[model samples]
Target: MKLVVQEFLTLDGVSQGPGAPDEDTSDGFTRGGWFVPFVDEEFMEIVDGWLAQADGLLLGRRTYENFARDWPAMTDHPNGAIMNGLPKYVATQSLTEAHWDPTTILAGNIVAEVDALKRQPGRELQIHGSARLAQSLLAAGLVDQLRLAIAPVVVGRGRRLFPEGSTPAGLRPVSQHTTKAGLSVHVFDTAGLPSYGIYEG
Candidate 1:
């Protein structure tokens, strides 16, 4: 199984709070819902395509809690059944019990646990909206592909996916496109450590 990370980001690279104004208020992040405006029919179609390829979901503690609470009740949503029914894995030490059906808590060396999961036979084991977990996996060179929907707005402050002093990575572009609502979607395959080069005058 290839670990794929799908994320929504602001122009300034803020990954926190892309759903609703109160979706993620951690650390006083008020600039929420920055990515909501760019959701057109085309964007949703693209998203649906991605969801169809998901064999399982890997989520962070916060994201897992949110999804576990909301997805079960979204009966009217077209993708609700898919979201609710997929096998879910959460990376956490704090969560002893998960109310969501088919959820497994991964504790003690999360990297190793996730690596073991990647060894299983399947399609894509996707990580959706778990920026922190995605960051850690990317740093460990475990993420095989990344799909980013970059909104055309600049959120002045929020937790970024790649913060200062983060591990450097190299990516080769697999695909890219801009939506009618100004979302620039990009897909990239992870390369190893970024190569450095010097320019001669």
Candidate 2:
């Protein structure tokens, strides 16, 4: 199974709370719902395409809990249906029981567990809105592809996709498209480690 990360980011790389004003207010992040202005057909198409290719879901505890609270009640929505039905693997040490159906707890060596999951027979394990888990995955070199919808907004203070101390890796852009609302959708294949060079005069 390939591991893919799908994210909605602001111009300044903020990834937190793109859905609602109160979605994720951690660290006093006041600028939420920044991506709402850019929601158009193109954005929805990209989101739908990601859902269509998902065989399962990999989530952090916070994201899993948030989904468990909201998605089950949205059975009528196509994306909600897909999210509720897909097998969800959560990486956490604190969660004792998961109320969400078809949830597997990945505790004790998360990287190894995810590595095992990737080796399993499946299409793609899609991850959404799990920033901390994403950092870990990137650090471990476990993420295969990254799909991003960059909105034209700048939230000066918020949790970013590539935070400080993140792994340095090269990314090869595989595809890109721009929406009328100024949202840039980019799909990138993960290249191994980054290379450095000095300019010679």
Best by lDDT: 1
Off by over 4 Å in 1: none
The stretch of ten residues in a row with the least summed lDDT in candidate 1 is 29-38
**lDDT per residue, candidate 1, 133-177, as tens digits?**
999999999999999999999989999999998999999999999
Worst 10 residues of 2 by lDDT: 41-50
> Candidate 2, residues 1-201: lDDT per residue as tens digits?
999999999989999999889998898988888999899987888788788989999999989999999989998886877888899999999998998888999988999999999999989998998988988898899999999999988879899999888889899999999999899999999999987999998
Q: How many residue pairs clash in each candidate?
A: 0, 0
How much is the lDDT of residue 103 in candidate 1? 90
TM-scores for candidates 1 onward, in order: 0.98, 0.96
